[model samples]
Target chain A: MSVRQTATAVRGRYQPRISLWWWLTKPSYLLFVLRELSSVFIAWFIVFLLLFVRAVYQGEGQYERFLDFAANPFVVFVNLVALAFVLLHTVTWFVLTPQALPLHLRGRRVPGGLIIASQYVGWLVVSAFVFWLVVGW
Target chain B: MRRRRPVEPLVWLLFSGGGVVTAILVPVLLVLLGLAFPLGWIDPPPYEHIHAVLGHWIARIVLLGLCVLGFVHWAHRFRYTLHEGLKLQRLDAQISLLCYGLALIGSVWAVYILLFTG
Candidate 1:
């Protein structure tokens, strides 16, 4: 066999083309892709938050303008969608946490459900505190 | 050929830490800043109040940490997505550099803005 033929054979054996729609084959895979995509929106939220902080640091006028921009219908819609995606990301993170951080209590393994539930409880407590700071203050 | 150290475990550690930060903090932030404030479900706080809350050193640190780790988390996930989903292992070096480089730059900018925006 020619060297060229051998090289072609080796390349063909080593590199199989992956399909573009590979993620669509399974719901879990699709969900994983979406969760990964959610980070973009989460990053967007962080940018917006940073802008808010900068505006606040500037003065009341800048802060008001930032609030107005945030309240615009288009911005609100984008934020709403981003919120959903981020929530999905958060839920998946919690669901996977028990596997990531396996804990043993009294020599037995802890249940995943309890770990996830505890995260939810912590979320609630933090949210309630923030809610108070925002509205109840 | 030179040998390379396995970096998967280090990347996984960052991914896990970022996941924990996002899970604990992102939802409440969304509910408060994204939904309630705009939807009128709750009265928005005054600018002075919001500013005061953020002026605290601890709040600034938390925000910086969240943004940095969140970006790192993103870089690691998207790196694997490009590698496995798109079969870009041939471009692995370039892809890793771009993804993690962006994360590092973003984290630095976030910290700078958070610290010096006053």
Candidate 2:
């Protein structure tokens, strides 16, 4: 074959295209995609938290303004949606933790279910601590 | 030029650590600070109380860690989501640059707010 034709043939080799909606084919796949998408909301929450911190740093007036902005219906709705997505992220992260990082106990691998349950226990403890901290000593 | 170390390991480290940290800490934080206080589901804490917690250096460090790891995790995950999931592999270089660049910028802003603003 001519050099140009050979180069063209090599470039024409089959390359499968993944559809954007491919994750929708299965419940688990969709959940995985949703988990990935949750990063956006996670980033949003971080930005929002920083803004709130800045407002607090500036003074009561700025903090009040931040609160007023946060209380807007559109902002509230978006945050509610973000909360749901973030919860999904949290649950899925814990459920998959064992698969990602398995534990061992004295020459035997720990049970995946046990590892998952331990994550929940840890989550509960941390959540409780945060609650206590926020609400006061 | 000095020898360069591969960054993939660091990226994965931050991603895993951020995943665990955010999973445990973020939900309740969002509920209380993002939703509850704003929506009046609970009374807002007094400004002095909020300020005192933030003024503490430990809290500032923890928050800085959270923001740095969180943004790095988002950058890594979103880069893959766009490259593989959405079939944008041809734009991989630009995507990586954009993702990690924005993450770096966010981390810097977080540091400024958490550390310098006080």
Candidate 3:
């Protein structure tokens, strides 16, 4: 009705909309969020292990039941989601690891992919040790 | 019960080591735990035995340390992500209101789980 009311209405009508990909406004930010999300998965995976340990402490029967609970369909779905997060974390770490620990080998900046591969290789070595510990074969 | 600081160098060492351990353990643990679910691999982790391995005081310590480190890392990462990603900054004061609120909640969760669990 009044001029002020008309201006307010015009501004409301012209409010911006949020697009799905609009989050890409800051690629770094997106990467950061992905980093957080990935870490959350990493956290959850740890929690699951902790639960496993707790169940074991309770005794064999408790352990079996807890293990079953963890393996439920809901958990499987959660694990799948975590799998997606692992992929996100792996990619993000590769992309940003270089930044976190910028290495210069022989007076040249090492490649990011190379850095990531090196970490993967290192992880494989650790995994082998765990495999040995757990399976002992 | 309301401690905000991480434990110590021992804890930090445990944290660093834990990530590598998780990468190694999760798949195997998954396979081992899979027996409970029909969809899991036929060869599972022999639940009771693995539980025996994990149920020690030492195991609990390791898990708690790892969870705290992982959560702290996640919170710090998310803070920057929100500030940078989505350009939530473009919006008015009300938008940042929720973002800050979430950060507080995340911090509280991290502190609560880490301090009280152990």
Candidate 4:
């Protein structure tokens, strides 16, 4: 047999089939899949934010309509679910940060806990600043 | 066989940068806009104030960057999810083009809205 024919035979003999329910087989795989799925909701939130900004820029009446739409029970529910996914994304991202960015201090690698703690602190500081700006101290 | 390009590095770079940005900002935005404001845990900012803030060039630029990077992040992740979860390796080129193409379109649309819209 020619090389092309042999290659074709080998490919035909050993094609691996993936199960549709493969993600359901393991808890960690399920979580990873969920983390990836969270990006859709994150994108939705960004789209909503952009729309809200546009409405605010349009003027008071438009902004009021945007608020009413946002305050609708279904919208609020969707946002709530998106919030949960975003929180998951945030936590998983923070936990993975140490691996993504390995830092060293005094020639010793920084611990993962320290990296995560710093992220939480940074989050608190930024959240506080935004809160102060919007709500006033 | 199709020639392979060195695009993975660039995509991974955007993915990491977007991840960092999303991690730092998404939670804060969610808490304020998603939960606190809606639940009245905190009084939402007035519309005029929001308008004023978004009117600033800096705010517009920041938002544009966030939206663009966020979409890029989604594109990369979803591409992999389709490849692995759906076992679509046979259609890798088509999937890659579709996913990244949409992200590019979204980023451009976001920029246009931010620049042209009120």
User: Which candidate leads the pack in lDDT?
Assistant: 2
Q: After superposition, how far is residue A81 of candidate 1 from its true place, in Å?
A: 1.3
Mark the regions of model 4 whose C-alpha exceeds 4 Å error after superposition: A1-10, B1-4
Please compute and give the TM-score of the first chain of candidate 3 against the native first chain: 0.67
Task: Estimate, for each residue in A1-137, the C-alpha lDDT of model 1 and write its tens digit.
Answer: 75533544688666455588889999988988898888778777877777777788788998889878888999899899988988898888888889978989999999999988998998888877866765546
Candidate 4: Cα lDDT at A86: 87
Indicate the residue-level lDDT of A73 in model 2. Answer: 90
Candidates ranked, most accurate by TM-score first: 2, 4, 1, 3
Sorted by lDDT (best first), the order is: 2, 4, 1, 3
Computed on alpha carbons, the lDDT of every model, listed in order, comes to 0.81, 0.86, 0.55, 0.83
Candidate 3 lDDT tens digits, B17-53: 5434444445444434433233644444565445454
In model 3, what is the error at residue A89, expressed in angstroms?
Answer: 0.5
Residue A98, candidate 4: C-alpha displacement in angstroms:
1.0
For model 3, the DockQ equals 0.23
Please report how far candidate 1 places residue B75 from its true position, in Å.
1.4
Q: Tens digits of per-residue lDDT for model 2 on B1-118?
A: 1123598788899999989888888898899888998889888778888888878898889888889898988998899889768877568789999999999999999988998896
Q: Count clashing pairs, candidate 2.
A: 0
- Residue A15 in model 2: shift from native, Å? 2.0
**Model 1 regions lying over 4 Å from their true place:** A1-10, B1-8
Compared with the true structure, what per-residue lDDT tens digits does model 4 show for residues B1-118?
Answer: 4345798888898888888788778777877776777777877787767777778898788888889999999999999899878877678899999989989998988898788888
Q: Model 2, which residues run further than 4 Å from truth?
A: A1-11, B1-5
Query: Model 1 residue A135 lDDT?
Result: 58
Q: After TM-score superposition, what is the CA distance of residue A47 in candidate 3 from its true location, in Å? A: 2.6
